[model samples]
Target chain A: MERPTLDQIWAWLDQIPDPEIPVISLVDLGVIRDALWKGDTLHLKVTPTYSGCPATAVINLDIQQHLRANGIDKLVLERQLSPAWTTDWISEKGRRNLQKFGIAPPPKDGEHGSYGALLGRVVECPRCGSKTTERISQFGSTPCKASYRCTECLEPFDYFKCI
Target chain B: MADKALFEFLTRIGDTTLVLGHRVSEWCGHAPALEEDIALANTALDLIGHTRMWLSRAGEVEGKGRTEDDLAFLREAHEFRNYLLVERPNEDFAVTITRQFLFDAWHRLMLISLQESSDQRVSEIAEKASKEVAYHVERSTDLVVRLGDGTEESHRRMQHAVDILWPYTGELFTDDETDRELSDRGIIPLPSSLEGEWKTHVDGVLSAATLVRPEREYAHKGGKAGVHTEHLGFLLAEMQVTHRAHPGATW
Candidate 1:
C-alpha cells in the first residue's frame, strides 16, 4: 500500500469532530497537534482541552477508528502535555462554526483575565449577536464552556470560555 | 535519591488533588444551588485531571509498572502523601468553600513558582495547571467574600470555617527532607518559600471577606511522611471500593 503523507493524515483527522462539540473538527479544535510518518507508522500528537476533559478518551478512540478506516493501520497517538491545549488555538473556522452552532466563541486576542467573567465583560450572544449577555455560571455542560444568558434575546448559550 | 524525591513530590500534589476532587464530587447533587453544584463537579473534574498528570509523572519516577490508576486507587491511606487539609470531610458549604479557598491560594503560588522549575516537565505541567487554577482561586475568593459579608449567619459560618481550617494551612508550608531535596535540585520550590506569597494572597481575601485571621501560628503536621488524618481512610474506602472490587474493570 502507498504511504499516506502527513497532509493526508491531517485531512483524515479533521474529518473527526470534537466529541463534545460536534460542530467543529478536531483539527479545527487544535488538539491534533501534529502528524508525521515515522517510516510505516503514523505518529500523531494530541493535547487535551482540559486535564480532566471526559472527551479525551472518546476523542482518542475516535481518532484511532478514523485513521484505521482510512487504511493507515500502523499508528501511534501520543498525548502531549508540555505546551498544554489552550482555547487560543481554536481555528478561525472553528470559532465561526461554534458561533453558528449557537455557542459564543472565545475572543481572538485572549486578553480576558481568568477573572474576566467577574468583571462583567461582554460576551456577545451567538443567537442575537447582542453584546448584552451575562455569564450564568463559570461552567457549562462541559469543562471547556461557560453558561451565558442574553437579556436581549432571552436565550441561554454556552461561551467557549478562555482558560 | 532524586527519583525518590521526585516521586514523593509528585504524589504529594497528585494524592492531594485526588482526595479533594473526590470530596468535591460528593457535593454533585447536594450543593447550595444548581450552578454551584455544576461548578463543584467541574472543579472536581479539573482536579482529577491534574491528578492524572502528577501521578503519571510519579509512576514514571518510581519506574514501576504502576499506572496513575494504581497510584490513585491502590495506595493505602498511610501510603498516601496528600496534606491533611484536603482529606477533611466537607462539613458544610462554608467549610468546603473555605477549604478550597485556602488550598487554591497556596496551590496558585506553588504552581507559579513551579513554572520556573529547572525541570522542563515540571515547569510545563505547572504552566498549564497555573491557568486552570487561576479560575479556581477566583471563584473560591468570590464565594468566601459573599458568604463572609452577606449576613449574620453566613458571616459567622464563614468565619468559623476559616478559624477551623487555619491550623492546617501551616502544614502546607512546612518543609521536610523530600521537599529539601526537590528544592535543592531545583525541580520544585521549597514549601516554606511559598508560604509568604500564600499568606499575602490569603490575607487579602480574608480582609476583603471581613473575616479575621486566626492569631495562632501553630499547625498540625505529618501528612508528608505518610501520616494522615483518620478521615482519609473512610474517604479512601468509599473511593476505592469500586476499583478494588473490580480490578482492571472498565465500562
Candidate 2:
C-alpha cells in the first residue's frame, strides 16, 4: 500500500469531534499537532487543549479507534506538553464553524493587543464584528477560553486565549 | 543534606504548591473575566505541574510506599505541611490576587535561591517553577495596581483584602529549624536573605498600588509543622474523600 500523507491522516482524523465540545472536530480545535506514517504504523502527535484536561484521554482513544475503524490498525498517539496549545492554532474555517455552532469564534486578526502591548486595547466581538464587547469573566466554559459578552449581539461567548 | 530533612523539605514544598494549585483551580470557570480566568487556570496548571515534580521527588527520597497521588490526596489536614498563606480562603478576586502576589514574590526569591540547591531534583523544579512564578507575580502585580488605584470601590476592596492578608505574609519569611538546616546545607534558600528581596519586590508593587505595607507583628506559624487552620480541614475533606474512600483507585 502507498504511504498515507499527512493530509490523508488529518482528513481521517477530522471525523473525531472533541469529546466535550462535539460541535467542533479535533482538527478544528487544533488539538492534533502532528501526524506521520512509519511504515505500516501511523504515529500521531497530539497536544491537549489544557494541561490535565479530562477529555485528553477520551480524545486520544477516539482518535485511535476512529483511525482503526478506517483500516489503519497500527496507530500510536503521542502527547506533547511543551510550547503549549494556543487559540492562534485554530484555523479560519474552524473559527467559522465555531461561530456557526453558536460558540463565538476567536477574535479576528489585529484585534486585542498582543502580550507586552499596552493595556486598555479593546477586544471586539467575534460575532457581528462589534468592538463594544464587555468581559464577563476571565474564565469561560473551558480552561482554554475566557467569557465575553457582546453589547451588540446581546450574547455571551468564549474567547479562545490568544496565547 | 540529611535524607530525612531533605525528604521533609521536599514534601513541604510539594504540599504548598499542590494545595495552592487546588485552590486556584476552583476558579477555573468562575473568574470575573475570561482572559483573567485562562491566565489564572494556566498559572494553576503550572503550579500543579511543579507540585507533581516536587512530590514525585519527595516520594523517591522517602523511599516510602507513597506515590505522588498518595502524598497529595491521602494526607489528612494536619499532615499537610503547606504554608498558612497558601491555605487562606479565596475570599474575592482582590483577596485571591493579594494572596498570589505575596506568594509569587516570596516564591521567586525562594526559587532563585533554590536554583543553586545542592540537590539536583530540587534545583531543577525550582529553576522551572521560578520562570512560571515570575509571570504569575508580574500579572498579579499589574492587577493589584490597577484595582488598588482604580475606581473608589475597587480601591476599597483591594485595600481591605491587603489588610486582611498582610498578617499571613509574615509566616512566609519565618525560618524554622527545617528551613535553617536546609539553608545551612545549601539545599534551599535562606529565609533571612530572601526576606529582603521579597520585601523589595512586594514593597515596590504595593507602592505602585498605593497600598500600605502592614507592619510585622507576631505572625501565625505552624503550618510548616502540619498545624493548619480550620479551613484546611474542610479543604482536605473535599480533596481527600475520594482517594481515602477508594484507597488506590485508578481510572
Candidate 3:
C-alpha cells in the first residue's frame, strides 16, 4: 500500500467545510496555511482568521478527523502566529463562494491604508449589487464578518470584514 | 536581573491585556447594538488571546512552572500589574468605547515600537499584536468620531466619558524602574517615548470627533507597581471564580 501524497491530503481537506460558513472549505478560507509529510508524520500549519475565533478548535478537530480517516495516524498541527492571517488571504474562489452564499466579500483592494480608507470602503450588496450600502456595525454574526444593510434592496447581510 | 525585568515587563503587557479583555467580555451580549455586541466580544477574545501569548512568555522568562492560567487566575489584585485604566469599571457604552479608544491608541504605538525589540519573541508578539491593534484603533476612532459628533445627547455622553477616563490615561506612558532597566538593554522601548505619538493620535481623533481633551490634574497611578483601583478586586473575583471553583477541569 502506497502512502498518501500531499495532494491527496489537500484534496481531502478541500472537502472539509468551515463550521460557521459551510459553503466555503477550510482551504478556500486560507486557514490551512501549509501541509506536507515528514517521515511518517503529516505536518500542517494553520492560521486562525481571528486570534480568538471559537471556531478554530472545531476547525482544527475537523482537519484532524478528515486526515485521520485517510489512514495518516501521525499528524502535527502547528498554529503559526507571526504574519497573522488577514481577509486579503481569502481566495478568489472563496470570495465568490461568500458572495453566492449571500455574504459580501471584502474589497479586492482591502488595504487599510488609513482611517479614511477603512471608513470609505464601498462593499457591493451581495443580493442587489447596490453601492448604497451602509455598515450597521463593525461586527457581525461571526468575528470575521461585519453587518451591513443595503439601501436599495433594503436587505441586511454579513460582510467578510477586512482584518 | 534582565530576565526578571523581561518577566515583569511581559506580565505588565499580559495583565493589562487580560484585565481589559475580561472587562470587555462583560459586554458580550449587553452592547448597545448587535453589531457592537459581536465587535466587543471579538475584541475581548483578541485581547485574551494576546494575554495568553504574553503571559506564557512571561512564565518562560521567569523560569517558573506557572502556566498562563496560573498567572491570570491565581494572582491577587495587588500582585496584578495591569494599568488602572483597564481595571476601571465599564460605566456605559460610551465609557467602554472611550476606554478602548484611549488604550488602543497607546497600545498601537507601544506595539509598533516593541516590534523592534532585541528580544526576538517580544518583537514577534509585538508584530502580530500591532496588526490587531491597528484595527482596534480604527474601530474606536471611528466610533469616537460618530458618537462625539453624532447628536447633542451622544456628544454630551462621549465628552463625559472621555473626561472621566482621562485621569487613567496618564499611567500608560509613565515608565518605572523595570521599564528603565529594560530600555537600557534595548529589550523594551521607553514608555515615555511613545507618549508624543500617542497624544498626537488622540488629539487627531478627538478633534475629528469635536471632543475636548480633559485637563484634570489628577492622574491615577500605581498599576505598574501592583497598585490598582478598587474595581480590580471584584473584576478578578468574577474572572477567576470559575477557575477557582473547578480546579483542573476542562471543557
In terms of DockQ, the best-performing candidate is 1
Local accuracy of candidate 3 as per-residue lDDT tens digits, B162-201: 9999999889888889999999999899999998888998
TM-score-best of 1 and 3? 1
TM-score of chain A, every prediction, order shown:
0.94, 0.82, 0.95
Candidate 1's residue-wise lDDT over A64-100, tens digit each?
A: 9988988988989998887777788999999999999
Q: For model 2, what is the alpha-carbon lDDT of residue B3? A: 82
Q: After superposition, how far is residue B160 of candidate 2 from its true place, in Å?
A: 4.8
Model 3: share of real contacts kept: 0.50
lDDT of 2 by residue, B1-251 (tens): 33888888887888999889988888978989767778788778878877877888888888876788988888788888899989899989999999998998788778778878887767766655664565566578788999988899989989898888888877777777878888888898767667777788788888999888877566888888898899888888888888888978986
- Report per-candidate DockQ: 0.61, 0.12, 0.50
Give the count of colliding residue pairs in each prediction.
0, 9, 0
Interface RMSD of 1: 2.1
Judged by DockQ relative to the true structure, which candidate is superior, 1 or 3?
1
- Among all windows of ten consecutive residues in candidate 1 chain B, which has the lowest summed lDDT? B1-10
Which tens-of-lDDT digit does each residue in A54-141 have in candidate 3? 8989999998898888887899999887676777778898889999999998875756423355767888999999999998877777
Candidate 2 or 3, higher TM-score?
Answer: 3
Report lDDT (Cα) of residue A129, candidate 2: 68
Alpha-carbon TM-score of each model against the true structure: 0.96, 0.70, 0.94
In model 3 chain B, the worst 10-residue window by lDDT is: B126-135
